[model samples]
Target: MAAGGSYGAALTDLGERLVGDVITPGDADYDEARKIFNTMIDRRPAAIAQCETAPDVAHAIRFARDHVLPLAVRGGGHSVAGMSLVDGGLVIDLRRMDAVTVDPGARTATVGGGAIMSGLDRATQPYGLATTGGRVSTTGVGGFVLGGGAGFLDRAFGLACDNLLSVDLVTAQGDQLHVDEKEHPELFWALHGGGGNFGVATAFTLRLHPLTTMTAMLLLWRPEAGPAVARAYRDFFESAPGQVGGGLLYLTGPPEEFVPDDMVDTLVCAVLLTYTGHEERARAITAPLLRLGHDAEMITELPYADLQCMLDDPPGYRNYWSAEYLDSFPDQAVDRFCARASDMVVPSPSQHVLFPQGAAVTEGPSDYPLPWRGAAWIVHPFGLWDDPADDARVRQWAHDTRADVRPWSRGAVYLNFIGREGRDRVIEGFGAENYHRLAGVKALYDPDNVFRLNHNIEPRIEPRPAGR
Candidate 1:
């Protein structure tokens, strides 16, 4: 079987025996298969094999290794960088393998790598159980967990990684390995936040918590009150209990029913709050924020699943996002945020989000390779528009806003939010020691580096060189 070419005969042989769809560049669904959530990234892979089982992933990994082809792994395909696809490589797409098995008696859930937040939430909601997941329902469980996951429940349960119990992965050598704190411990630790450098994770057994009712709301204020609102939000988050988690977003008014017709499209400061405690106590916990002067209030008691989808953005909308971690949201930082926020030029609704950091995130730096544990806020500047022509404007806006606030940042960026930058940013995503450690583990599990498409950490034979 010839396996040396881009579209090798070996791949064809493997696809024939596989149970999933094999998408080639000429296929009718290829365009949709290659499409990602971020409109800014458009790449064409040589082929995309949507895996249906762990063995299917193993087959894809073996094919990429034998063919010496660049490989990308797609879970939810929501990466801002679109690392899920490569220009001339094989993409082991996992979107079709989204299955969730809940062990409610054990308080655990074993989820397929391709499962999205909504799928997992729906499966676990019947038991009133959930783990830390992305705020948006569409985010994938695989990439989000492998990178450090933050969501409305993070403050209470810690990151998604903290709840991870075990993972089923297909290594570069085509052998399956089950990793956990007790077995293959180092590899497990690296997988916590090391991105997709180690292997293709097929499924994860995660610890779940009982999550019943919670309070979720969006509080809006005029632009003039930005400074005061920032101050109030900063103070409130400083001492808020772990049960409370959310962010303050500086955004243009939405042209929806929630806002009055006259205020539509006007700039405003919106505090998005979610408290995962008893419904009655949630009010008291968020009292400081709710009291801040605002133009409108949309607070309500909702189930955890409903709250998860409350902020879902349309799938195909154009989006450009840049994120950073701040040591503190001091008055100076707030001033800078407000200054750049005031200059948002996109007529569409763009936003600057300030998410609180700490609580479980600060337990230990060694727990996960993810930096920014001590950060006071995780700032994300999201530029949204509906037209391809406006793509340049939104991209530039996200970049400029990120640059404007760079000085106040902690020199740390969220791996999930990073785009197609090179190795330097990848190394920076995991601090030096963690990066080196992850590299060594990557070498053991995937020496050929078949999973080179993400924020890659090159597999190393020995420890990383001194300075690198």
Candidate 2:
């Protein structure tokens, strides 16, 4: 948190030029500006520049660099590690920049860096066009896409990054550049699964797909049925088409009509099958699960945007999330996954989910940083609860789930699903070879390593020629 002697004076000057407000520790709204999605993370940044334009972002970067304060970029403000918030540093808050412009003819959407998933989804939904976005509506589009977005539609449309067309970036040195496959090819490639290591992305152009109607079938059963349901779900996904996507989760059932009174507010296993097609066809394809005889059921066809918001976790809960991608989910693994449900805090928003991966996810671009896409299954422990007392138990449950499934692990990490585990996991997220390549790109754009918050990729310095 140290800075040079003139840092305080320089910050005063930097705040004067911005169209958006610059919030410091003394400001009445400072605490509000610093709040992120994860309630557990509380950071006191030296300043928060709520950027209204890319130029504003560039200037903030310049000022932070000159003052020698660490920099953190805030998009969606949903980082579980709270990477978007830095302690006693500068934060480039992009929430004000959210604006979505869609080109139905071109099948693409250009989104502001600060926009959330709902903004992009609502804009494109009117056109009967869609894209792969995060499962939750409130998740920031910038962070989700940059971290390799995956959601209910991912199996059908591919990960959100797979649909990315271009990005507008503001480098650590305050240079603005447009990167696409044609321009800054290597830099464009790094954006695939690379965390925000190179720069602050001011905007993104993403490809869109046609999705007229989306269907979801939620079937639930008692906790004792989890092992059976898990095994059946795994078998079903083995041959299901790419349009079939969703997860088998152990959660406390909500007070829905379909949910039995006994199951409501109690832990139960649920299988959700999301199909990109219409209701009748989707139901026909997933009839096997329908016949499994669940304690409750809810099947409906809804707008893609509406489906995205259905699972929005209520905000006040403390969160601790993690994931482990698996090479295969055998019957034994199913039992282990089900057993971990006992450790989860019952009647909470916690979910012990097993996601199937394949089809479009595995068949997508192989060279991208998403090496974990090839895994057959993903075990995600998304924990949320209201009490600080349950913090230790939630953390332990996530840790134990990863440990229990270590044998089946493919040794890959999904950067978005897990919190900041360590440097080694970051390297594993992108394969070692891809990590090296990303480091080189990081060196070129961020040689000084100004953006080191998110699953950071260290810059590799290239030596000058002997003649020099």
- In candidate 1, which residue pairs get closer than 3 Å at backbone N, Cα or C atoms, i.e. clash? none
What is the TM-score of each predicted model, taking all chains together?
0.94, 0.97
Residue-wise lDDT of candidate 2 within 153-264, one digit each (tens)?
A: 8888889999999999999889999999999999999999997998999999999999988998889999998898888888889999999898999999999988889999
Cα lDDT listed for each candidate: 0.82, 0.91
- Model 2 lDDT, residue 98, Cα: 97
- Predicted structure with the largest lDDT when compared to the true one: 2
- Candidate 2: which stretches are off by over 4 Å? 1-9, 464-468
TM-score of model 1 relative to the true fold? 0.94
Per model, state how many residue pairs clash: 0, 0
